[model samples]
Target chain A: MALKAPLAYETKHHLSYYECDATGHPSLSMLISMAVQVSEEHGNSLGLDTAAIQSYGGGWVITSYEGSFAAQQPINGEEVILGTRAIANNRFFALREFWIQSADRQVEYVRLTGLFVYMNLQTRHLMSIPQAVIEPYHGPEKKRLPRLAKARELKDVRFKNDYHVRFFDIDSNRHVNNARYFDWMQDPLGAEFLTHHQLKHMTMRYEKEVRYGQTVTSEISSPYRNENGELTTDHRIVVDGQLAAASTMIWYE
Target chain B: MALKAPLAYETKHHLSYYECDATGHPSLSMLISMAVQVSEEHGNSLGLDTAAIQSYGGGWVITSYEGSFAAQQPINGEEVILGTRAIANNRFFALREFWIQSADRQVEYVRLTGLFVYMNLQTRHLMSIPQAVIEPYHGPEKKRLPRLAKARELKDVRFKNDYHVRFFDIDSNRHVNNARYFDWMQDPLGAEFLTHHQLKHMTMRYEKEVRYGQTVTSEISSPYRNENGELTTDHRIVVDGQLAAASTMIWYE
Candidate 1:
């Protein structure tokens, strides 16, 4: 039997100019910020504030995400509705979905899918989703969590350099913006290399979530052969040698 | 002698909601977005593109500014310092000042004292400030820009309400964050009483600047010795207007 997904809390956020990307629309990192916000509110509505969860010696972490962008995102100052729902739960994993809509027409702007894992804060080891956490969501035990897009495999995934997390990297919500990962993931490649190549397609899979005051050391390495006999690259954002996010980018010459 | 003030080309901007006030920030009627930005990057030292500045009109317009604040007022990531120079023309007043900072510190921040005036777009009523806009800064021309602030004579003042502008009320340049003025100046009064107050002291002066979108506003009005025995309740930001910011709280309860 499938457990009934809980209707998580929803919030309305007004887009700010600082949230927009060079495309004149909200950047992908901003969407993740909204998702993270709604998820926190969802937990709060369930009486699971981070402090309380930490008290239990367990904390929530994002394991992976498979999100989709429907169209150009909202512009600054536009009110957008953010909705999050608890979709599924298992011994070690929980699934959530996020939706963003414009205030005027309630038209969808972006939809996101995320996977969360419970972990021991002290040990940084994965923990089973406690029965108490799952019971509140009214979810069932029989349904399996959906699979994420597998990170592209490469023969020469080289570990490049490390990045230090700065205070400005944290937002009002206290976590780094998701899009910032792209910066860290790309920075090691050198500014000249980045300027010379354009990202044609990129698929990022988040394996874990890093929090404030945590210096996430990223390891990026990409090596691949394209159909046209050209070299390609796959990247990884790792925190202390653990994979946090992975991406495969098709570059423009 | 005022050293030659920075000479920069004019630029443009578009206003966003985050730049607006819930109560008194820029009102709907005064929603000209790009003008302030043009002034901030007037010289375009940060490498702004021409294609971006050509929107709305060939020129940017700043209608008026009411107040000022100290350092720590600017918002995060805001591009500033372009519009800090004044033009030679009196009608196209170029009110400009830069943020003061101590030595040996990296120039991470600056405050721009901006002066603006209104002009007709179609007719170019005031027209553009020509080469002489640089005159005042070269040396005090014995010319005085209109004062934005003067101490109110408390005895004869009759204030219907107090005024306030919050920390968030100021912008990145820190001068009473311009966005806050809309809500600060207008929100204290009511729809029924809009016509009663002829603003003579709209000039707000800066002492210590508010930082990063803090909720603040100004408290103002002519003083009155009322029936409550020296009772002076000009105006307060009541929830329904009950002293939200910069309110005058009497201890005499």
Candidate 2:
């Protein structure tokens, strides 16, 4: 009998200076992109590439993500390890986990969990997961998967900014890159807060997809203490008064 | 006698899907970023890193770029070679050449030449090239350097779009990433032209540095035939009615 493919995969990446922000660390969007890249690589390694998945008339789309960051983030030009693992999947839902850490494994920079669902690209509706695509990972089928943390609604908006989505913002997936949400969500906080504070934790939920040539208004509430006494901020991306995405971020000085 | 360092340097980079556009090839901005990265690596290899150059109270700033692309472009997940060579320099200016080719050296994807000048970060004024910074490259001293192709002024604007500079667009250099100009310049062309056509040659000139929180208007002229009978377009970026950057791009279907 042939050995089964591993459920997890890891790859080494050199953090280029272009990937880093003004803080000299990898930006949140780039980190998310890295995770997405690793997951795709994992799928490809298992012979379930995009073509194979799309052949089932659907593609995987992320629904939500919750993650935390370590105090020490990897700097530009540093070599780090990116990893992803298939956790569980059912007929309609799949769960995956991701992380970025130092080469020696001494420092884990980020840890994230994402919930995904197969969607029919032509109709843009949820669809049942394909067995041929999911079975290769060997993730046990679960009747019910654990839910990701929900993003809180924005209340008492203190800052708001409007952004026009440009052409380059879209990727090969034919939609705005999901990682771009972090940019819109965080830009309203201004550079002062961004430079002085570091993101400790975040929960983001994508409610709808934003298209090209559309404008998005990102709003954020003033920093306040949460139940855990952490400095927290609530963010929401609205399109024509409809909430497209929401997130809550915890920051530390 | 000590041997002088080589005037040219080369490195390999794997093009990630995130770096590519909806067309499944690297975007113009990402290609420029890759060139900038290799040039920085070249400087570092010669013991003239950013810190060493900043010690002279100035940094290298690109004034112009002119490049041509081959019929074949590298796609995502492909490893390509990035190379840079210090061509020549004078007291106030330097010229460098860059290229991106296949790993096997069989296909030359992009060949570009950039004109650079040292600028004082605090005063934002042109400064004389520092000896310690330029001498290590071993580029011959020139009385007068060759000028890049000047961008034609946009006439009879057929399309225009506005872009709000986001915080993430700024890099560690504390200003907008220069490569981003390519996005602003090409976005107004619309997706139809971008998807069906491939950039054959381009010449871009930067006039003023764009800052955060500023809205820039990008304008482009309709496709017209040039003297060489090649289909061409003219692009210009304006800030507060002032021309910030200009470019001319030749495209092939």
Candidate 3:
């Protein structure tokens, strides 16, 4: 019989006060932090250490991500399980999936899918993944990495505003939280907008993940302003054309 | 001139959700995790590492700490400073002070004093300080460390009955926020007790500091129920024989 490939590794985490938002639930940034930790662990389990990857002249860089949060989040004292798996890998990219499940396993509070690029650390550019790095995972080569949905420029959109990444936005991973991109993507709209309009639908696709120690520009496109009075805006989270994430938010009256 | 004692070192940190509290400030427990990292740096300055301490059949453990908070706490994007000093050491114990400062030097959000003891890791019992550990700090010996004020056990305090550490109470340090003790210390009577009952007289003295991964037991003495009808309580935060902290709340209606 052919050997079986493990789906993923699991880690347990406890909720901390720092992870919560104004609503008392874990903040969008914290949800991303948990996802990154699980991803790192997934890489380590495959025998890919920082030095090992560096030695290959490339490092893993998150290219894009999509996460969906369902129901209310975990609160303080809750024991959460974070799990990740290697879905597929290619010469230049890899795809991974992560989840945060409740102890009872009855509910999945969060689900995330991310694409990462193998990059040359020195040149600060994308590079091909080495077979040495790819062969160990045993994922299929035929898998396709999805293309991010195009975002209309803010000038073309109805809402436009700017925000600077604050100190707290940076995590131990030294990167902006994946979920926070949603905030920056939407902050330009006023609270009046958020209150009167709820996010009826959203599709965020990442082209790059912003890292710590760097500043980027976030631009939003005009809302499509649908007939039912619902509004939809398209956004591009960018660090100078390394498109970080492209998203669309549909708000309802 | 002897260099003003190499006082700090660098450490990488992983941001965890529990570290931030309800106000979105990095809680006391998170501060301690960074403090522990700084403490490890202080030991490294003395040529001590985990293996070195273990080789001697004992390890350093913190017994107590006293911390003062400034007006504002650390929020998300800022890079914080971690520092420690072996202020004094005696045959039995050592007193170390650790701090988490803002990057711009604009704030010293947390000022902490820790009491440490050398103990046999296997037995989990206190042992005398080794000459090897004490000789490096180069400080005069004192019979007793500076004392912390004790919370008066009062008989007239009211119990509010609404204080509990939630799951988010746990931080990266794996403990509840020490400042939280103040909440438990103050909450029993609730804010109403504060407004109606004149705190004409109140005091809190911390004897020991709490740490991560430990459960703290708190109890308050019955209010004496004076003629004024104001409630008062004597609060004690304890673990085993160790007195963690003490406070006395008084109300004058």
Compare the candidates by TM-score and give the number of the best one: 2
Better of 2 and 3 by TM-score: 2
Candidate 3 Cα outliers beyond 4 Å, as residue runs: A1-3, A143-161, A165-183, A189-202, A205-217, A221-232, A238-244, A250-253, B1-253
State how far residue B219 of model 1 sits from its true place (Å): 38
For each candidate, report its DockQ versus the true two-chain complex.
0.03, 0.74, 0.03
Q: Mind listing the fnat for each candidate?
A: 0.00, 0.65, 0.02
Q: Rate residue A5 of model 3 by lDDT.
A: 77
| Model 2 per-residue lDDT tens digits across residues B29-98 | 9999999989988888888889999999999999999999998999878999999998889999999999
- The docking quality of candidate 3, as DockQ, is 0.03
TM-score value, chain A, candidate 2:
0.97
Q: Candidate 1 versus the native: TM-score?
A: 0.48
Model 2 Cα shift for residue B210 (angstroms): 1.0
lDDT of 1 by residue, B1-253 (tens): 5466545443222222233222212232123123344443443443322223323233433443332323232232233332244433353565644332223223323333335443344564645444333342442333567544332322332333333222222222223434444334444444323323222223333222333323344444654444556423343222332333232211121
Report the poorest 10 consecutive residues by lDDT, candidate 3 chain A: A166-175
lDDT of 3 at A91: 71
Per-residue CA lDDT of candidate 1, range A204-226, in tens?
A: 77767765445566555554557
| lDDT values, one for every candidate | 0.49, 0.91, 0.61
Question: What proportion of true contacts does candidate 1 retain?
Answer: 0.00
